[model samples]
Structure formats: C-alpha cells, structure tokens
Target: MAPKAWTTKEVEAALRGQCEGRHRVAPGLYLRIEAPKPGEGGRASWSFRYQINGRSRIMGLGAVGDVTLAAARRKAEEALLLVRGGADPLTLREQRAREAAAAALAARMPSFREAAQQHIESQQAGWRNEKHAAQWAATLETYAYPHFGDVPVDRIDTDHVRAALNPIWTTKPETASRVRGRIEAVLDSAKVRGWRSGENPARWKGHLALLLPKKAKVQAVEHHAALDWRDLPAFWGALAARGGAAALALRFAILTAARSGEVLGATWAEIDTVQRLWTIPAARMKAGREHRVPLSDAALAVLAEARAAGDGEGDARVFAGRGSGGGLSSMAITMMLRKMKRPGTKKPWTDAAGETVTAHGFRSTFRDWAGEATHHPREVIEQALAHGLKDKAEAAYARGDLLTKRATLMAEWATYCTRPAGAVLPMHKAAAQ
Candidate 1:
C-alpha cells in the first residue's frame, strides 16, 4: 500500500516478534513481511503485492541474501510487463493445464490386454459360467499377453495380431480361432470407446484367412478313445464296481451321450418322471438351443435312486455339491473321476491320441461305442447326442423331436452298460430295445 515496495530491513523492523528479522518484498508493489522464527532454517524471501481487475496479487522474487539486488530489480520489472499486457498469468496457467490434458488424451490408446478386459466385462452377463471368463484370462495370459498386450491397441495391425496367433493356429486351431475372436471383440470395443479406429486387427474372415490356411483344413485332427461296442459290456462292469460321484457322473455321461456340462448342471426340475425326459434349458446348452434328453428305464432308475438319496444340497441340482450354492462345476465331473482312483486309468487318463481326455471325451466314448458296435446311422447317433447338424436340410426343417429314436438308443445303451463283465449276450435279447 505504501509506494508498493519496501526493503528487507524496513519490513523486518515492522514485525518486532519472537525471532530475528527476515523480510519479504513483493515483486513490483508494496511488500509486507515477517521475520524468521527461532528455528527457521532456510534463508529469507522477498515478496510484493499488487492488483489487477480488483483481485489482489502477491509475487515472490527470490530469497533476500541469495538474490542479488540487480536480479531482484529485474524480476520486478518483468512482472510489470506481464501485468501491463492485460493478461492474467493465473488464467494463462489454467489454459496451459487444459492444453496438456487434451494432448494426453490424444496420445492415449488402449492396449490389447486392456481392451480384452473391457470386452470380458461387457459380455460377462451373457456367458453361462466362470469358464468363459477363465478361458479368456488363461488364453490371453498364455498367448496374447506376451505379444501386443503392452502395445497400444490403436497401433496394432492385422499382421501383429496374426503373429501372436499363427504359431498355434494349426496344431491348436480351435484354441487359436477362439483367441483370435476374443482379440477381435477387444478391438471392436476399443473402437466404440474412441481409442481405436480402422479395420479390426483380429478379423478372420477377410483378413486373417488370407494369411492363414482355413482352420478346418489346417487344424490338427484329434481322435477319441472309445470302447469296442463289445468291450462296453466289460467297461460298464469296471465302472460300476467303482462307486462315487465320478463313477456316477461317468455312468450318467455314457447313458446320456450328453456333454459334461449338460450332465453336471442337471437339476431335479429338468427331469419329468411322467414324461421320461430331461429338458435342458437353452441357456445351459452349448449349442444355445433347448434340448430334450430321453431317459431310458436305467437312466430313470439312476435318477430315482439319486432322488431317493435326498441329498439335494444345493438348489436341487441333481448332482449338486455338499455346500449349497450351485450345481457341480464343469470340472466337478472330472474331479469326480480322479477321486475314484480306478486302475487302467492314467493318473490322468490319455485319449486315443494319447492326449489328456476330458469330461467331454466321455461323450465321444459313447458315440464311438454307438457307431462302431451298432448299425445306427451317424445322423441318428448325432440326434441321439444333440450335435449341431451337418445335414443342413434336417437342421433347417426338422421340427420333430426324434424322441422315440432317442429313447430306443438310451435303452440299448443302458443295457450295454448294465450287462455284467462276462455276460455272453444281451440280458433282454428277447424283448430288446
């Protein structure tokens, strides 16, 4: 206020307090200052106060003893220029901050790993179980995580994605194809979020197919281990002698020829004793279609016995666990097998190809038995097993349930299963299914 400037000594004298005097001189105007406290360790600074548009302003030059008198004077003069230019330096600082924010946004891009996480979160509700989430995380962590997982998604090209996938595409075609599809979904989500623009780096039909061979042709073929329809009589006996959830689940899998998930997720509500069928809801099915599993007398007997046991621990799941929450996990059946500790069973059993077999492979065992042992057409067996049709005509126009044929197949299958190990012939050959 008084000539808008004061010296270090004058300001300090004004502040006659508990410690030695150290003053502040405002850069270009009146200075009000305080002295150092007893333990104030650093050197003293000078400050000046001014006004622009009715807003008070205070500017600091540098420490009194460190800054030469000439430097201090020069800073004050430059501040005068800034004030006269009619620009508020505070406003300019804010504008610079906004510019920095915009620049950062422009340079930001989603990474392949990041985009995938977003995609997984988006589609999580639609998937049937944690397996979908688990598979995505496993494949990405195993494959894509090492490649473009750290690369910016917008910078990724089809070739970059292909390189990540090509190594396993032929030998592990199904897995590779699934990984590629997951990548495509990630990029599409990135595009939606405005972090990406251009053709999807993982698109297969037009782009990847050009670089890689057709998946069906280049894919490695796998074979399933099946019993000689004649050997099934003995296999069933060995399986029957072993008793536990695994033994029971295996028996169910064989009789139904249904996928492992279908059997594991089976519940009492789906089975109708009067109707002699298990109606799996569409959501639980892999083909995303509702299916009817025709129950034979033996299959119904298993259910009736299970229901009689009255161990509906969780949600009335026909094979639910001891603690109530949901049906057996997809691995529930596999773990059940490992628990049984059967001989001639690999610590982890191998397939016909000598690869590890899975719960699903049991379905193959049934289909194999049905085909190699009997005179049934493959289509009939497929209908009995609910495979997606290869016959486009039947797929397009088939409205009938094929329930009668399925019942016959199930009855014969059950008989094949229940036949004692050394039984010379079918038990009910006279009134056969």
Candidate 2:
C-alpha cells in the first residue's frame, strides 16, 4: 500500500507538535521530528529512504530550517532515480565531497618553489653571508625546479624528489647532496607551517639512503688545490710583483692564513694598526665565534697600500672595490690566482696534482708549513687558522686565543713568505725530530 504524500500544512504541523517520530511524505521520503531534551530545542529534518540491490539505506537531506518541502521533494526524486539506476546516491555524494575537500586543500597549499623561497628568506638572517642564500636558490633552481617546483607542497612525494636527485646523484654528488638537503629543509618548513604533512621525501639518513649510493662511495673527497710549501717563496715573489687590490688582498690572506670570504669581506673597523690585529666578528666567521688575527708586518703593509688607495677609516672596506665604497668581489683573489704565472715561467701556478691554485688553498699551505717546517704547537697553529678544537675536552680547557704564541708564529710565517726567490729555509730541527 502506498503511503499518502505529505502536504506543506501536515509537515509544518508535525514539526510544531515536536513528536519523536518519522512521518512519510512520499514513497521514499520522510519528515523526521525529535522531541526537545535537556536544555535543547526540538529538531526537524528531511531524510530519504530507498532500497538498492535489496539493501535499504537512509540519507539525510538537510535541516527543516534549510530544506523546504518542495526542495526536499526534488532531492528525493533525484535519489529515487539514482536507486532505480542501481547506484547508491549516498556513496556518490560522499565521493564528490571528498574530491571537493582535496581540491580546496590543494588551493590552500603553496607550490614547492614558493615554499623553498619562503624558507630561504626565513633562514637568511642566520646564514653567514648572502652567498649562502644565493647558493641555495641556485642549486634548487638548477636541479629541483624543473621536476616539481610548481607542484603543491602537500603533493610533493618521493617520486618528485627522486627525479630531481637521480640524474646528478652520481655525477655531481656534492651538489646533489646539497639539493636533497635543501629540498628536505623546505618541505620541513612547509610541514611546520601546516601547509603539508607526512614524511619528508628528501630525507637522506633512512629514506633516500636506501634508494641512492652513499655520497662518499660515489665520489672521493676533494680538497682545494694548493701550491706546495716548497714552491711558495717563488710564487709569493711573483704575486707581489702584480699590482692590484686583489693581489694585495691575496697577499694579506696568505699571510693571515684566513679563509677567502673572511679576507674579501674585511672592513677597516675590524682592523687595528696600533695593536696589529684583524678582528673578524662572529657574524662573518664560519665558526660563529669572534677570531683575532695577529697581523704580520707584511699583512699590515698590504693594508697600508689599500688605505692609501681609499678611505681607511671606520666601516670602510679594507680592500675597496672599484665600485663605490664596497668591498672587493669574492672572486677577486681567485681570478688573480688563476692569472698569476710561476716565477720566470708562463705556466700558471698549480698544485702537484696539476689543478689550478685556489685562494682557499693558502690555509692548507700555512697549516703544512706550521706543522712540517716550524716548532709551533698544533693547538696554536689551529687557533691561528681559526679552526675549532675537535676534542671537546681540549676545547673546554682552552680559554685563551694563544695570542702571544700565535703572534710569534705568524711573524715567522711572514719571514718565510717574504724570503727572496730561490731561497730554501731548513725545516725546524724540532719538527724534523
């Protein structure tokens, strides 16, 4: 027997009565009213009842306040048609809802490129230099961007990261490793901001490690190319003959055994001519600690030349560039080294391995000379080179910068560096012993 279709007045009357029961409106539709309970008002809503494949199901349309009688009838008719076609309307509705939710979530999440840029900006203040930020951006753009940069951060998976890393993983292991780490960092930042979730696809220790060969296994560790200490005196003489801010900067760097960035970024305020000290601030230092370099007469003379060429007062660049008041370019010394010729020969100065000499190689040269040719203690040499003590016990015990001992050691280094071409100094008997 077919139940009577409910009229608008019957539906309103049933809702007003607040009865706890379902009243049929049509063959597959009902108006449900629930009695008030414990400080809550009565409730009225619309529901559709139907059978598909001999299984009966109920689906809520909406509240009485939202679904009108006519609208409820239209919805029920649609559901009845779906039932007749052997499809469950409830399942289809839920599927559409899930798809809509995913689309909205994707809209809210940033692309990998945008997330990477934001992460880099947030971390820039802590980085030692602008070059570090530049390197991060460059590596990601060159490797990761083409593969998945425009993809939403939440959608970035292992496959996307693997595609970016696999090509250069074996060929350029160092760069590939940095790219992987950077991608991991960006994704981590995204997760922290709630823009993404799940495991980091670029993680190396346990995840990517399983997929790729270890970095060390793929390539041997490569040190900077350095001039042999034996060949330094002649090389020094030739470098001295050249006249430029870069040449002077290189000479100062070699004398102090400082890193290239440290040398290139030097300012007049960091130097003290009276005290013979070049104090590098913690912000500019790699170890993030202030280091005092006891300047040699040669280093000071180079400074004097630089001062004569430009303003030598507070905050001025020690090696002023041709561009207004700025420090010399970081590549200045490297380019100078590449162009420099060995004494009386057209050949460019190179390490024993025949690689071109690098500005940073001077630190290695100084360490070799201090260890193999001088009687200076290891810690003093390391301190002069601004290296942190590897031994925690030794480091904790060491309070002083060993200024007096290092001053003397640097003086001796200065003497060796200024020696005439073809002169050979004997190794320290103590070192030899």
Candidate 3:
C-alpha cells in the first residue's frame, strides 16, 4: 500500500509527540526526531541532500522548529541550484566560515598605539637625539593618543585626525603641525606593512588644509625676547662681577657667540688653549656641522677660571652642574641674568623693552653690535655666529669659515663688552666715495 503523503500536521506531531526516527518530506529534504530521554526533551532537525560532481552530500538546514519543513524544502531547492552550478554546498559553507573567521581576526588586530611605538623604535636610530625620539612619542601621547590611540589603524579616518588637531591648531600651531605630520607618517608606515589600507587621514595639504585655518596666518612669528645692544656693556659689567659656573658660562657664551647648549655641553677635549679655539662637534651644534669658535682673550680667561674651579674630573663637562659629572642645566645662565641688579635701581637689569634678557638673546646683542659698531664683513660676522648660509650657491662656493678674521672680530667684541659701562667708542667712519 502507498503511504499517505506527509502533511504539516504529520510533521509537527512526529516532532512533538515523540514518534521515533526519521521521515522524508520530499526528494531531497528530511526531518529527524529523537524520543524523549530520562531528563531531557526530544529534539528535531532538518537536513538537505544534493548531488555535486556526481557525489551526494547532506547539509544541515537548521533545527526543525528554527527552520520549518516549508523552509527546509526551499533551502533544499537552493542547495540543488548550487549543486547544478558545479559548487559543493559543504565546501561553500566552509569558505564562508573561513571568511568570517578572517574578518574577526582582522578586527582584533593591533591598534594605532602599538603601531606608533613600533614605528618610533624602527626610526629612532635616524633621529638626532634621545630628546627627539622622546618628543615624537610625547607629542603623540599628549595630543593624539587620548583620542585615537586605541582605534585600529585600518579604521582611522579623516574625522579622527581632525579631532586630534582642531583644538590645538590655533593655540599651539607649531606643536599641532608636528603632531599631524607624525600621525601621517605612522599611518603611512602601517599601510606599507599591510596592516592598513587607505588614504592617510592626517594629510595636511588639500585634505586638512581645507578644514583648518592657514598655519602661517594664524600664528605670528615670535622672535625670542632680546637684550638691547646698547644696554649690554652695562649688563656685562654687572655679570662680570658675579662669580660661579653660571656667570662664567654666560660670559663665555657672550664672548664666543655660541648657543647655550653648546656652551653647557663643552668639555675640556673640545677646547684648545694653544690654538685659542673651541672646537664644538657636529653632534652638539645646531647646524649639525662642526664649528670652530675663536676663544677671545676674555673667553680664554673664562675657561681658565672654569678649569681652576675644578668643574669636574678628567674629560668632564667644563661647566659641570651640581650633579656629579652632569653638565649645567639649561636654566643655569638664565637664572643668573634674572638675579643681576641694575647699577642705580634695585630692579633687575632688563633689556630696553623692560623684559629680562634671555641667554639666547645675547646672540641678537652680538648681531646688533656687529651691524652698528663694527666694519667687519657680514660673512665674517655670520661665521662668528656659526650661522648656516641661506644662499645655496653662496654656501657651496664659500668653503672658508673666515676663521682668521673671526679671531680678530671676536677679540674686538670681547674688548668692547669688557670696557667700562657708558664708555664711548668711535663708530667706524665709512670712507667717502
């Protein structure tokens, strides 16, 4: 006898009423039911059978309640279509599973913070100093990391870059500019490593340039507060009387026209008493070129005083700090300038602008004196200052540093600064044409 065809009622009853094993719904669809056991209710599930490449395979559609008989039949039709299309249903399922797993793994990848650290470490050797590396990490930590550090590099976008830079763009333009560049560099490196793929969100030109105010327009050029060249003789008189490493260092800086860092980092090895020259290594110089500073009579005297004071042990800093074997703090000379009292008034000796003069500003004082009082050539003055040449062709052809002329100029400068306060000097009279 032919069995009655399966209906919806028959299928539900088979599953709910615990009628044992399996029933075929259609040619390729089936529902399997298990009898109730000791402490658990029975469960039912659906499977679809299809032939791919002449091999029959079974695929689970879903649980019976989750996927009804009608749904299973529809799925069976879909699977059969896939089989006719020459694709294995099980293999297709596995491929989809692998794709999903890959997506999850990628989503769990290391974020911008990790990538930035790795990038900094990789490029640390090429940077100028430990401070340079520290600054790169510090700026990112202060301004950028709080906002987007944990975001996966693959997902960083324009909005993230904007958020990090916008607040400080107007207030701290220089720092903000640097931070933006760093973010761009780290992202570019991440893309090259296959961890990220997209246009860099931190790009300034065209992308961010449109959004933010022009940096040059927003920030005014601020020159360092400088001491007037006129007040220098009086200031020098007061400075010469003060005795200590700081005072001597300040005097040396003025006489040599060297930067405070170069003065502070000076060692006995860098000095030559016989040659009357102070040879600052390229590493210590701002231009990254070795500089020879002519030690004027006064400058040699200051060095002689420093050596006699026992600044340190062998090959130690010529101006050692209170800390053993350490160079003087950058503030040491500035603090000395702050403490000097004006000759008549109890107030501190300040520049013409009434602001305290900076150690760095003394370079401006030297420049003013050279321009207004002396007949030395501009190149000689520039060379004495250890300034890099602005003209490329001029720099290329000008092999000589004018050291011979600089020695004479520096000695004259030392004489002028050491002269009694308010003394008059005959200004150079230009020869009439």
TM for every model, in the order presented, reads 0.67, 0.70, 0.70
lDDT of 1 by residue, 1-433 (tens): 5445556565455544423443334446333344545888434555545578989777666665566545776666766777788766556657888999767755777577877887888888888778878898899888888887988888888777878897898889889988888888888888988888878868877878888888889877665444445556666666677654555666777788887778877887888889898899988888888999888887887776667554643347786554553565666656654453325754544454545456666677778767766665666678887887787887898776677776777787787778776676433221233
Best by lDDT: 2
Q: Estimate the TM-score for candidate 2.
A: 0.70
Runs in model 3 lying further than 4 Å from the true structure: 1-108, 311-315, 428-433
Clashing pairs in 3: none
Q: Quote model 3's TM-score.
A: 0.70
lDDT order of candidates, top first: 2, 3, 1
Off by over 4 Å in 2: 1-107, 424-433
Write candidate 2's Cα lDDT for 161-214 as tens digits.
999999999989989989999999999999998998888989988899999999
In the range 86-150, model 3's lDDT, one tens digit per residue, is 88888999999999976775567768998899799999999877888999999999999999999
By TM-score, highest first, what's the ranking?
2, 3, 1
